[model samples]
Target: MSSTLLFFIVLAAMALAYYIGRQRAIGVVGGVSQINRLHSLPSYYGYYAALLVGLPAMLLLLLWVGLQGQILTALTLAELPPEVTADLSEGQLSLLTSDIRNLASGNLMGRDPSPAVEAAAARFQQLQQIATLSLWALTGAVVLAGMAWAWQHTKPSFRARNRVESILMLVMILFSLIAILTTLGIVLSVLFESIRFFQMVPWTEFLFGTRWSPQIALRAEQVGASGAFGAIPLFTGTLLISFIAMLLAVPVGLLSAVYLAEYAPRKVRAWAKPVLEILAGIPTVVYGFFAALTVAPFFRDLGQSVGLDVASESALAAGLVMGIMIVPFVSSLSEDVINAVPQSLRDGSYALGATQSETIRRIIFPAALPGIVGGVLLAVSRAIGETMIVVMAAGLAANLTANPLASVTTVTVQIVTLLTGDQEFDSAKTLAAFALGLTLFVVTLVLNVIALHIVRKYREQYD
Candidate 1:
């Protein structure tokens, strides 16, 4: 049977186990009226029985399904003659198994298979069928055994509620550990790859070098193939664009948030907030198109009319559109934090004869400063991490210049460029992507730490 069908069957079995356990618990206490003799409610016995049946059976099914492919492939390979496998590397052997399984399942292979490959494919299919049948039998047996054990243990004195709670708590803890470990694994993996990249290219050059050409030549005879990996220009471009984005976004977003929260009528606020937030739902790729086609051209013409030089694709164009994109994030978050401030504070300010403007500036703004800072930080991160807009609007020149009209590139754009196609991971060119990623992560982390310090300081001063 299919795993999905077997999953539903297991669920049905668990439901039956629940019913049986509940009835048994009631019977043990003599009747529903005399259920006070039982330690827990009859529903607790039902839950305990369902848990007992489902947990073991589901775990077994999950492990069996996870390992079934490996086991089948191993059996198929073992059945093949020793000489057939002796010449293949680990990677080639894996590919051979994948192709055999694909052929057995009536899928196309890259080329016609040999006699040994055909035989292996047949063996794989046979093993897969046997494995599936065995899984169903084992899972059903486990469910039945769990049900019987639950039925036997559903006595009046059994602490079914405690057992159920303990099991759930353990499950929750296990999931939490999995999440923490996943995050740790990601960081360590990036850190190690970045270390490898640094080992090849000096850290000093990568960090302070002005150019970022990562095209390493495939052959030593190729001219101009030794690429530079200085990231200073990328860093400068990223900061410049993000700075411009925030410069436009923070004031517009924050002020709009204030007006909507404190000045707009209820009828206006209801529709205006949602309409404003619709900007956030628009895809970033669409913003990229708008930046490239509309904003960039407009800026070019404006700069030309004013007798100023403007690149066709420049940081100013990308930043302006990016700023518009993050407006909703800033406005929505700031509005929420503003609304969260106590009404009592406003009333007290009014009683002290403070004007509304004065009260907002002195009391409300400072009180809401932390959340405002947090919202602004989120928008900043969004701006920094933006790829499509930069790629489409700002040309990837990586020129070390402060002029917004000049063409520049960011680190994210470089990372995307370096890892765009099928490439070897061992080369410094590919490993440079990992180094760039780790640097971005560290920069973001530092920014967050600074934001936290700002929030704490303002919170202490205001509260």
Candidate 2:
């Protein structure tokens, strides 16, 4: 059975268990009228029974689903003759399994399968059927056993509420650990692969070298494929675009925020805020198309008219569109932060004979500065991490220049390029993606720390 259908079956069983347990609790107390004799409420008994019925079945399903793939693969492969499997390497074996999987799923898109692969695919389907049947049978039996146990224990003196709460607490902890462990697993995997990449290419060169070519020589005879692994150009381009974006985003977004939060009429604020924030809802690819088709062309033509060189895909166009895109993030957050400032500050400034502008500059703006900084920081992150816009508007050339008019690329674009298509995971080229990911992580972390420091330094405390 499919997991979703099985889950619903379990849910139905839990409901049955709950009803039976509630009836049993009432019976043990001599009737519904005498239910006060029970240690916990009858509904608590019902909840306890539902938990008992569901938990064991869910665990069984999870374990079965986890091991089902590997077990079936092994059984399918084993069904093939020794001669069929004897010479294939691990990558080839993986591909064979993939083909079998696709074929069993009726994908029928890849190369025609050999007789051995056809046999394996059939066997895989058969094993999958058997495994799913066994899963359903085992889960049903466990659910029945749990219902019986709960029915037996649903008595007047049972502390059903306490036991159910304890079980739920443990489950909450388990889910929390799942989230933490998932993050840890991702970090460790990237770190290990980055270590492998650094072994193949020097860390110093990757970090500080100005040249950014990553086309490593495949054979000793290849002349132009000598790799230069410097990431300085990637970082430079990322910052230049992000810098341009922030330059446009901050002042306009901040001032607009101030206006909306303090000066705008309620009627205007109602529709205007959502309209302004519509930019954030627009897809990045749409922004990319706009930049490539309209913004980039306009910039190139304008620059040409002024007798200045401008690449077809320049950082300026991408950054401007990106700045427009991120405006909502800055405006919405800053407006909310400004509105959060106590009205007493404004009142005090007015009482001291200060004008509205003076009150905003001296009191409200300063009070809201930390939160505004936070919004701006989020906008900066958005600009830095954006890929689709940069891909379309800024051409993918990792030129080590400070010029925003020149075509350049960010680390994210290169990461995507390196990992695209069929790749040997152990190759230095594929592994470079991990190194770039790690670098981006470190840079973002540093930015977060610096932003936090600034926020703390200028933070205003209120009574």
User: Highest lDDT, which number?
Assistant: 1
lDDT of 2 by residue, 283-346 (tens): 9999999999999999999999999999999999999999999889999999998898889988
Predicted structure with the largest TM-score when compared to the true one: 1
lDDT of 1 by residue, 241-303 (tens): 999999999999999999998899999999999999999999999999999999999999999
lDDT of 1: 0.91
Query: Which parts of model 1 are misplaced by more than 4 Å?
Result: 89-91, 453-463
